[model samples]
Every structure is written in structure tokens, then in C-alpha cells.
Target: MRQLVTVSCVLLLAVSGFAQEDSSQPRPFVEIAEQDVKPSVQAIAPIDDTNVFFLNKRGQAGVAKFSPGLSLIGWELYSKVKLNSLNSLGMGPNYSLVTASPIEITQAFDTAGDGSLDFFQGLVRDWQGRDNGVRITAGPVADSNGRLLFALSPFSIEEGQPPLARLVAWHPDSEGLQTVTESQLLISSFSVGPDSLLAARLSMPAYTEGYYISLTGLPSFLADSPDAVPDPLPKTLPSLLIPAELTGGKEPTQMCFFGENNQTKLVLTCPESNQLIEIVPEKSGSQWQGAILLRSQTPSSIESVVEMNSGLLLGGGPDGFFPLEIPAEAFRIESVNIAKDGIVLNFSEEVDRFQGVKPDSYTVKAVSLRGDNKTLMVEPVIESDGKTVILKTSEIGKGVVLRVVCQNLPSADGDALFNKTVFYTIHES
Candidate 1:
């Protein structure tokens, strides 16, 4: 009887060791099940590599820790602000977290390093309830200098005044807020790149309901002077007017900047296409221009996207949290540059040649706000590079938005194009 009992103890110990080893191994991040992530997440920010911070509509902020088996496992609510809705969240220097609402920007501190932001201190309420009838619209991005920058647009306007919108910044080291720029167009969302190159998403909700994305070179003088009157950004990036065809039915919730200073790029989520949109900023002789193209797509609708410390993308949606993976030779139109004859279509992936050379693969439409829409038949000629397709036509017009429907275009890897359409605003050629 003693020998049998001793054998049972050894077997029990062996099973327990195996279970612990299996649970300790980290699981693949991409395999995060829908049930694992929180629902109705308004904004998501990476607190660190192993933890993700998220906010909800009820002004509740929480930290989710990534664990061995369950991805982003622990959901701990430690801070709650007075704002009804949290628009965006950012990781700041010398602070645990920073959040923006329609009314104010709040800073929190997790002094214990336990993901519990115990101290709620410092509120920037430079604007009042009816102060100029303006509210924070889009961002409160923490730039490299640790200054919190955001945009403000008027909720009410005096007749003939043309609602005033402003871009403002507040540094942690200073008591006075600096005014970046004051413009007539509503500055919806914005981010500052290397050397104060501002990439802003603007909208005119009252008059036209028009949404525009601008990549403008911030005036060098404004960088030094806090009170310098700046040039309107619409006159700078010249503003890419987004059309209904490009919007995929809803305006983008937020935009993010990534890559180096010279190769800086913008990425935003398109819920309708279930893809990410990339905007490449270009500068020539004091003028700023850029092109918008489709990027990668995930299985879920990603909103409130934030960059990870390791250069990865993490977003939340109704489905859950997921990583934006670099797909295998993902076919997409990388640029839509103006051509002498018509427009140039640049693809990120090498074309299959057979289907890419077909003119029917692209349907071009010249759209104007004046109720004139014309269809231009494309003559596709694949360039020698195997990815650039030149569409020869004479219909490219100024003040027009080109809606190009890409169909049956596949990459060399036999993958279909990620997005179906590309909208480009043409100001020249």
C-alpha cells in the first residue's frame, strides 16, 4: 500500500509541472479572440509593450495587461475623468497618462507603477463653457517636446464672421498656453511631425460638411515665437478635399504618424473598407502636397489606433483588440500623382501584368461639387517597374476629386487588392 501511494504522488507532481509550463508560454498576439478584448472601446493607447490603455464613452479609463495565454488580459479601471466622452489618449513624459475630452485635457499618474493611476491632477481649462463658443475637436497629441497640442473649433458662430478655429499647444514646463495657428476652417484632428511639420485633418461641418486632410510645413518663425500669427494651413498643404466615395460612409475617428522624419507617413482607419489609409506628405519649394492611398486591412473594424513602443499598431473596435500585420505582398495603390495626360497609379506590390494592363481594371470618374460628374475611360499601360500603371487620359481637372475604382487587380502573390477605390483631389494637371 505504501508503494502505490508514493507512485500517485509522483504522477500528480508531473501533471502540475506540465500545466504551469504550458500556461507560462506567451501566446501569439494575432490570435486574440473576440471574447478576449473589451467592447465599446473609445480610445486605445499603448501604456507599454505588455500593457494597453483604453478609455470608454463613460469617461472611465482602464489598463489592460498582456499575459501569457490571454492577450491583453487584466482589465483594471483606475481613473475616471469628468468628461462624458474621451476623444483621445496619449502617453506623456513624466506622467502616467494624458487624455482629452471635448471640454478639457487631464493628466493622471500611476505613482505606484501598478497600472493604477492614483493621482488625478492638473486640468487645462483655458477655454470656458461658452468661451468663444469653441471646444476641443480632435487631438491632444504629445509631441516630442512633451507639449500637449490640440485643436479647437467653434460650436457657434456670429453671422458673417466665418467660425474661427485654432490650433493650441501647452507645455508641461510652462504656465502660458501657446497659440499655434488660428484659421477659419475647423481643425478637427492634428499631429506634429519632426521639425513642427503639422499634419491636420480638418472639417467644415456647418456649411459644407466637408472633411479635408492637410500636411503643411509649420512656419519656422512660429516655432520660436509663441504669439506669432501663422498662415492658414489650407493655404499651406493646400488641403486634400475628401469626397463621399473616399470616406467609406464615415469620417475617420483619428489619424496617426509613423516612420522617420524624412519618410513620415500618416495612417487612419476606414471602417467601411475595413482597411487603413496611408497619406504620404511631399514638400517642394515651400509648398506641401500629399497623396492618400489604401494600406492594410484586418478582420475587424479598428478605431482609436495607437502606435506601440516597438513600432507595431494596436487598435480597438466592436470586435476587439488586434494588431495590424504587414500582409504578404498586400496589393494597394500607393500613390495617385498627377500626370501630364491624366494620373499615375503607383502600386506597392508588383503587378500580375496580365490583369493590371487591362483598362477595365480601373474605372475613373471626375467628380465636381457643381453637379457635373464625368466618366473617363482609362488607357492602362503598365510601366517598366511592374507596379506603376499610367492611365492616359485628358480629363484630369483642377478642383476635382478623382474616384478610381480598382477591380480585378491582383498582386504577383495572387492576393487581391485590399481596397476597391481611391479618391484623389487634383489641383494641377
Candidate 2:
């Protein structure tokens, strides 16, 4: 028999007094402040607007609450696990932290349930039954329906045996765990979309291509029987394959569902390609298209990306952590003024020093009366704020057309410049 699950909605306040001022800037270098835990943090999860949970590589978890001023109100050790890998974290009702380890999934509740949660492991040992190769990579996503779902795959594949990718669901009401769907392809990530639809990333072994599948009729798959496995894939289920080129030639390592109903979109993080791709419904609201929204350079790899407020918090191999304002657009030339000594150029945002502030990084050309382009010698001086620059050159004559070509300029968050050329026409002066 199928059990009905009730979804709960909670209202959370927007964090106030946490917005950074224009005068302040994100630190360029990684620093270990006194407030940070001694060991390095491998993953982070927000329990709420004020409380955050962090886990290290060694499985040590800590919880800290922040004040309105962004100061640490309190810090304490949460738990220590036996596993070395912490796959992902999700927040449940009543400040519960649902942690997905390599072997099992556990949820730690702030309030004790029958005085056993304080020592409760919540580990289901018999689920995999001593199969060390079986691992849970993607999730333990606590959907609004009060059920936890995750993607599981085997590490070691045996000959003649198909690689099994299973979507398992655990229902708190029924206290039952069952496999929702099984596939021959590898399922790396999964997320619950609108109307209880399931979206997943599917890849094949040794294949450079992958796809995104949207499974409908998810409510019919939840079961009370522990051994219930759907036979031969449901024909009624609708599956969509996102184009390989749209995925940037790599499988998505992470995925999340964003936006409200009818406007919801799927956001994917492709680590190998260092890109964030989005899948949204077309104008007709019938088909879907994928687009690359952000791409990191050589030195940086996007390990994790989460959407908060109007921006994305990016953290990865690089030692820096910063926000990437959404709706990524080209940095515009805010203002250009002709000064007594030189020409000043101001950008809409702060620019990095990676070849951007150097004179050799630009080619200044002057157009003569005959419409001939001549390279001009100029000295470039970057302002202290890193957003404005000045170019010192000889006196400008009437009808002189000046063109500046900037190459490989990156922003503070490692976003490359889009516009390469800027033209200025000098009037009589």
C-alpha cells in the first residue's frame, strides 16, 4: 500500500545587516582566522539563516550561529563520524542536519527524540549489506514531502553485470526504504522539481557524453514494501535527454532546483568543464534548452555552487571564496573622461590584476587624418580601487580617433572580460 506524505512549509526571514558595503572587498588571499576551526573545512551546509554547519575531511562536524553583525554568536562541535567522505548535507525540520556519508545517511536533530537522538546513529547497515563498492554520491535530498531520496552506484563493476544506478527513497512515515527507479546508465546527481518531478544526470562509462532525464509520476513509485523494485522501467515515465554539447562535454557533478512554480529551472555544476549550466523551459513551455551561464579559468575549478538571494556563492579548488552576481553580463565601461594629463577609464566593477593593469596587455592605436592606424606608446596606471585605470599619452589632436584593445582581462571573481575594444573620438580642444 502507498503511504501519503505531507509536505511542510516554513517561513524564513531574510538575513539583514549582512550585505557587504562597496568600500569593503573580499580578501584576495585565504586566511585562517581565529574563529575558524583548526582543521580545514571540506563542506558547508546552512541549517538556517543564522546557523551554519561545517564538516571536515576527517568527518568532524561543527555548528556555528552568526549574529546580525556576522559575528560568531556561538560555536560547538556537533558530531564525529567513522566515515572519511561526507558526500552532501541537507536541512530538515527543526534544525536537523541530514548528512550523507559514503555508506549511510544520518540526520541529527537539535531536539532529542526519546533521549536516543543524542546517541542515535540513524545508520541503516543492512541497506547495502557489506557491499563496500556500493556508494551514494549525489544526494539525500529532503524533499518538501518529508522523504529523503538519493542516488546510488557501484564503484567496482563486474563483467556481464550491468552498472546499476538506483534512486532510493526513505519515508519517515512508513519507516520504509525502497528503490524508486533503476537504470543501466550512471546517475550522478538528482533533484526534485515542480509537480514532484525527478530530474537526474545520467552518464555512461568511458563516454564523454551525458544527459539529463526528467522522470514523471514519482508519487506512484513510493512504496511501503522494502523489497519493492519496479520492473523493466515504467513506460509512462517521461524522460528527456539534454544535449551533450549543452553540458560542455562533461557530466554534471551537482544539481539543484531553483525558482518558483512555472518558472523553476535546473542548475547544474560541471566540474571537469568548470561551468555552471542551466536548463529552462522554452518560450512555448513545452521543450527545454540548456545554456552555459558561468565558466572558470585554468587555475580555478568550481567544486560547489549554491544560489543564495540574488547571487551564487562559489567555492572550489581555488583558495578563494566569493559571490558571483547572477545574470552574468559583460563588465561595461562606466565612464571615460579626457583629463589634462591622461585619459581615465572606469569600469562597472573591480578588475583583477591578471594582465589587465599592464600596458603591454593593451594596444593603443591612433587614427591619423589619412585614416591610418598607428600604435601609440602609452603608460597605464591602475587605480588603488582596481576598477579605474589611466592611460598617459601624447597630446591629442583634432579628429583623432583612438582605439584601445584590451586582452585577457579578468574580474575579481575570475570572470573574463567580454568586450575587447573601446573606441574614443577626440573633438577639437
lDDT of each: 0.64, 0.53
lDDT (10s digit) by residue, model 2, range 1-429: 221111111011013332212223322221123454333444556554445565555655655554433345555556654345454566665445677765667666534332112433343333442255777766777666666787677422345665566666766444445666666666666777666657776655465544545443355544454344556443212144443554467666666666623356666666676665555432213323222222322234554444443323433323322233343355744445556766676666777776666788777776653567788777888889988878887755544556666665677777766545554445333
Clashes of each: 0, 0
Best by TM-score: 1
lDDT: worst 10-residue window of model 2? 4-13
Lowest summed-lDDT stretch of 10 residues in model 1?
Answer: 1-10
Q: After superposition, how far is residue 116 of candidate 1 from its true place, in Å?
A: 1.8
TM-score for candidate 1, residues paired by index: 0.74
The clash number for model 1 is: 0
